[model samples]
Target: MAIIKLSAIERRRLSAFATCLVLSVFAWLFTALSSQQKYKVKLLAVFKNSPQKRAFHSLQPDSIYATVQGTGWKMLFSRMNGDDNKISIDLSALENKNYVVLSTQLKQINAKRDIERQVVSIDPDTLYFDLSNRLIKRVPVRLVTALNYQQQFAQSDAINIKPSYVTISGPADVLAKITYWQTDSLILNNLNESFNARVNLHPPAEGNLTVLPKSVTVKIPVDEFTEKTMQIPVKLIHNRNFYDVKIFPQKVKVTFTTSLKDYPDINEDDFEAVADLDQWLQGYRVLTVRLTHMPSYSKIVKIEPMNVDFIVKK
Candidate 1:
């Protein structure tokens, strides 16, 4: 090999190439450093397959902690393959404890090989929770009505519901305060026949209790209905010498029906039978009696012998 001498210009070119190579390496290092960052994510520790015997009233934080780690473009993308960022805690370890805390290991990191060795301290080493024992209870339902059909139609009858009780189940503390439950209002307006409905029960406002059976079946009996018309004995307000006028239908007919339970208490007086003959002349004959006024519980199915014949005398 012959010794070769390089010119100043050639030497300068060699130096420039070396400097470019060094800068390229530094640029790559700077880019990677900027792209990487330490992120803290909350890890939820859950006890799987925990025994039912464990109550909800007991729980602690020290039993769980989050894993600390560094995330970047490369690792984050690789995470989808098989790298799990989360870990599950053993619930059996929390038995009989109201609270617990746990310390987690610092996960993977990417940095200057030296910087990567730095360990990060997690803010919290443990988590807290409440354990409750599941429970079930039975509650009775009460039905209330604002309208009184019994008094309106002079019918002594009552509406009733079936399966007046239901079962409710939830957390023990939540079920303890619950008392009697109620269903939505059952409307009886214009109800000519019996009806049945499935209603839901609402739990008391302030409690953790949950109703197991949310809904109930109700059978409402409207009771048999009946009506009657009775002739009213009308006495003229004026003396006998008053203008000649006649009241027809000296007797009025009455009709009605009711539930067997109330049939005995029902009578002609329960209905008002009246005939209007004030406009009739002394010789006027043939009057009609009308029935009005009925108890709420009682429905006027129909006025038996709807028409009655009477003579009006003036």
Candidate 2:
């Protein structure tokens, strides 16, 4: 086959024609998109200024379609920005009525928006609410945490949260089912010192729930732990025949770790070790030594002799 090549003059003429055609297409598109027109966009419905005397729950979802009159450029820019666009609806009319007409508030809502984004109409023009008895209650706040401690460090005392409870107001049925509110996760790593911070409570995602003082102060005590050894006397119990039992190595070394602050206060009396005579009845020669009592904050490392030999004097 023979290749047909165009001369330089022919190539220049073709390039000029192609450039003109492209420019013409762009000009037409620019004119069309610049014209103002009505378009539908999905907007989130945000309720505001709720009735003070009445509690209400919306009958429809928070999403609604809004017919807005604006240029294609403006609409395109709005979409590129984000989808968080929302329309605020005034609910003060619910004090006397159970429904609100979206058209009635269109003027007020549009007052805060730009001239190009005049909302012409809204689908589901009417909004209805279910009214209920208003209830106010105080509930406890629970702190959620994911914490990691350094070696030889631990929580020393009970966690303290200021204003441990928060007041909540909502429909009676909704509030009745809620017993406690939770804070956002208090996550940390390699925590060696006490933690004191203001944690925010998770906001209610649905219904007309309201939480007062949305944040609280949390304080957690931390300290360095050191090992301590104590000799605790063992006592025998559960002899059905009331036989006098003697246990060898009457005292066992109890190894545990406690905070430095409480090390001086902790004594052998704070711990109780006992051996069960029932072990002999169960055909076991050695009785298991168990620590039945110890401080709540102390960590038991180990017992010197887990089992002890016991003799029964019949």
TM-score, model 1 to reference: 0.33
The CA lDDT at 7 in model 2 is 100
287 in model 2: Cα distance from truth in Å?
A: 1.5
Q: State the lDDT of candidate 1 residue by residue for 1-314, as single tens digits.
A: 99888999999999999999999999987677457566544433334434345444323442223333344543444345533333444445446665434343233322222242233544454545466666767878877545445532432444444566777655677677777778766556655445577766664342223444666676655554444434444323333345444443344444445665566766655666554454244543434456555444555555434444444244
> For model 2, how does the per-residue alpha-carbon lDDT over 247-281 read when each residue is reduced to its tens digit?
99899999999999899999989999999987788
Which candidate number maximizes lDDT? Answer: 2
Give stretches of model 1 more than 4 Å off.
Answer: 1-132, 144-158, 170-176, 203-207, 223-314
Off by over 4 Å in 2: 1-4
TM-score of every model versus the real structure:
0.33, 0.91
Q: What RMSD does each model have against the real structure?
A: 16.8, 2.1
For candidate 2, the lDDT comes to 0.91
Error of 2 at 136 (Å): 2.3
